[model samples]
Target: MLCIGFDVGGTNARGCLMEFTDATAPPRQLAEVKERIRDTRAPSQVAAVMADIATRLVEQEGVDPAQIESAGVGIAGQLDKTGNTVVGAPNLGWTNVPFKSVLVESLAGAGFTPPVRIVNDLAANVWGEFCVGAARGHQDVLAVYVGTGVGGGVIAAGKLYGGHGGKAGEIGHSKVVPHGAPCGCGQRGCVEAYVGGRRLEERLTQDYRAGRSLGLRPYLPVELRDVDHMHMDAIIRPDVADAAAAAGELYADGLWSYVADLLAMAIANGAMVLNPGLILLGGGVLRNTKELSRRVVERIPSYILRAAADDIEIRFGELGDDAGVYGAALLARG
Candidate 1:
């Protein structure tokens, strides 16, 4: 069977063509393409870009369009209960967009017609991990991805668990403190406010501006140090995970350690409620800073209940950036 998978984010859209026969085995990648999203606010435009990428993949691989059985997209946004509409995508500046319909129309225009599935990006990542990555053998799993923002997904009793509103596993917004740091979600004390890559960058920038001395400062570019205002491009952006990793080499006991401790506490709290058998942590932050995950692993046992902590296993994801694409393809197979 041939499947197409896409992982659409705020900045880029990535698609892959895969061939698979067995549900348990990893799919074989035939072709892949990526494109920058010129404008996130227009759902049709983004969908058309993805369709173009898919078309290119098929043409690159010399595959018959009729052979494509299904396609899936893992997108960063709040999806409606049916998963056909994007209720809101803060990064994409979208609301109540019929993304699946737009994608279908775009694909049809590109001469490829197949059943399409849309899911939360984190859910796809977790599904990918559960199916063929770190959590493959675990029946109950929890996955936390710490990128520009923190997000999570859950698998319960060997099935993906979408809560009553089909938006479970929003661990980032779960409050860890009362009236503490502010989050982009308009909430105070969210876990994301403490450990998310964007939040961390903001905090670091603030510290630098206030002359509070950040370990991340020395590793930053000379131009970044002289900036008087907060600018995403001028500052050490979260997408550049290597800067955080570099700072950690000499300052393991600084702000990064504190962030790791807070993240571990959040994961431990999650474990207490979900009792998941396995926990998988990924995303740009954790992937680049090995010490961060190490600190999280070391501290989780201290926060979680003894009984629950004893049986839980934690590991980083194995698929790296490809988890979403792989998971989407496997999900389409269903």
Candidate 2:
């Protein structure tokens, strides 16, 4: 049977098509595609986008619709235990939508009537790693992926552990400070609010404007406060060589330490509560900035109980950008 997996996030939707002949056979990847949804908030629009993706896969690969058996979709927000209702995805501007049914209907119209199953994106990630990626063979595991925002999942006693309402493992939403940076979830003090890529960029930009002394050329406005102008040009004093070099290191260290501490706290809390056998970390932010990941890894043990934290393994996720897709596909197989 053919199965499909879709990973829908605030910025993009990625899908993969698979063919499996038997329960023991390794899945054959038939097609992979990535698309951007123009109207993420509308379930109908999202369904249409997914429908198109499925149709293209079947057609391009010369597969009959009847061969498709099931589909699993992962999303970056909360869902009911049944995984059919979108409780609330502030980033997608969606709330209480019948996502699974809507998507099934659209796919049916496109010559595919496969059953659709959905789960949180982070859950998808942890499952992928646990089954075939870095955390493979591990029964108790935790995964936190840092991207445009943060999302994570936990596995306990050999099963994916979603709390009663399926909103467990939301480490990103935990408040890091009383009234810190605002998060995309419309709240403040979240770990994501502090270290998310976009938020980090915005914070650094604001810091430079506020005179934190980074090495980048300063932007000065003639009419703006704390800005000076000379004739037609606005000028700021150039930082001395040593000061500029030191400032650059200071700026970077300042951001990394803050991010590391925030992650450490979240990891420690999750570890103390779950005591997973392994912790898998991944995503664009972690992939690109290795040292940040290193810093967090180094700082995590300090945040948790001595014995519990000592033995648990911490490793980067191995699936790269395909984690959600692989996990979703695994879910579809079930």
Q: Which one wins on TM-score?
A: 1
Reference-based lDDT, residue 285, model 2: 74
Off by over 4 Å in 2: 20-27, 39-41, 216-248
Encode model 1's per-residue lDDT on 1-334: one tens digit a residue. 8989899888899999988766666778888899999455488899889888988999999987778898988999988988899999877888899898999999999988888899998888889888878888899998999988899999999988889998999999888888989999998999899888888777656655565545455556766655553342454554333455534444434666677778888888988999999988998877766766677889988899887789899888998888898887777667
Q: What is the TM-score of each candidate against the true structure?
A: 0.90, 0.85
TM-score of model 1 (CA atoms): 0.90
- Pull out the clashing pairs in model 1: none
Q: Which ten residues in a row have the lowest lDDT in candidate 1?
A: 232-241
Residue-pair clashes per candidate: 0, 0
